[model samples]
Target: MTGPHALKPFLLAFPGPLRDRLVAAVLSGEKTATTGLLLEYEAEKEELPEVGERSALIDSDGREVAVVEITEVQVLPLRDADLRLALAEGEGYRSVAEWRAGHENFWHGEEMREALGDPGFVVDGDTMLVVEWFRVVEVLREA
Candidate 1:
């Protein structure tokens, strides 16, 4: 597995606004109950090899926002099952189906999809990457 040090550069180079938008869209819902709408953003700032920065912000509803934190917009070699498993474990879900159900419900099902627009996609072989962007306000954690 790659260490945080190895990933730190990539994470730091990610775009902030993009990360915020995605986090807002993903975290906005009753089921999810995210502390902030601002999550993390990532995007490509130029045609150069790798260029960008990661940022955190907050939304109007007083939520934390992640902005422009993604440098590479390509797909990672993780399957849907793997992604689901990782999300479940990270989000403290018992199963993939449970996580999916929560997402669907929290995202307001298909209706919400129409409002948010179609999902982004960057497919490479079996890998897939999604890109997005948005602005956000920052939130400070309690000591």
Candidate 2:
């Protein structure tokens, strides 16, 4: 049933460190074009999912950091006629519950809390900040 607000949430979950790196790249303007970064990351994937896909995150050096599972891929075709046709044909209905359920299985069920608690080292110019335990819950992407 499509309505005024018929959009699903898309999560771009990444490893805590990799997320931080991307955030830094954004803030620093080093990676001015975010789309390029996404493309680069996407290219590194060895395989794609059959249904709604997920990806394994890689660091700047192309090393595996974590896995990113796209639980849902809601297509909102802008053309009203197209959308209407899609809705009428039952083409947009997809169960995301199974995909959502797999998140726990990724990374040993390590919640964001646990990732933050691990030791982290941050360097700022000549100064360095070594945090024994840090807690951060920052949204990477939502669309």
Candidate 3:
């Protein structure tokens, strides 16, 4: 217990308010799913999460607040992103339009742009997404 935890870090977003909200959602069971651009995994050379895989949910302050187990993972296009998935994110999007609108804002944010090394990067219908669903297994800490 003196060193870093063994599980890989499962981060929802950047380290700030956005991530804080996301962590809260996960911890409270309001959020059970998340979507990420396939481009991000490609850029980082990361593999897709498999069913039953476990990870440490790292919060904005670098604390492992919980352990999450992946239940499902789907790779689909932006056009295929559905309301069910959106609703599971627990951000209170009532429609697909609302979800896409919110996601577009984040996908086009400066931090994401910088991470992708493209200031003008934009998401489109053809854009691929890695939609993952997970359940919190254990909560290690609180906010």
Candidate with top TM-score is 3
- Candidate 3: which stretches are off by over 4 Å? 1-5
Q: By TM-score, highest first, what's the ranking? A: 3, 1, 2
- Candidate 3 has a TM-score of 0.96
lDDT tens digits, residue span 1-143, model 2: 13664322212236466445553443333321111111222334522222333333334444433333433222221211122222222212233333222322332234432444423322122321111111112223321
Q: Rank the candidates by lDDT, best first.
A: 3, 1, 2
Q: Give the per-residue lDDT digits (tens) of candidate 3, residues 1-143.
A: 12665888899989999999999999999999999999999999999999999999998889889999999999999999888998999898899999999999999999999999999999999999999999999999985
TM-scores vs. true structure, each candidate: 0.33, 0.22, 0.96
Counting clashing residue pairs in each candidate, in order, gives: 34, 0, 0
Candidate 1 lDDT trough over 10 residues, lowest sum: 30-39
**Poorest lDDT segment (10 consecutive residues) of candidate 3:** 1-10
Clashing pairs in 2: none
Off by over 4 Å in 2: 1-20, 23-52, 76-143
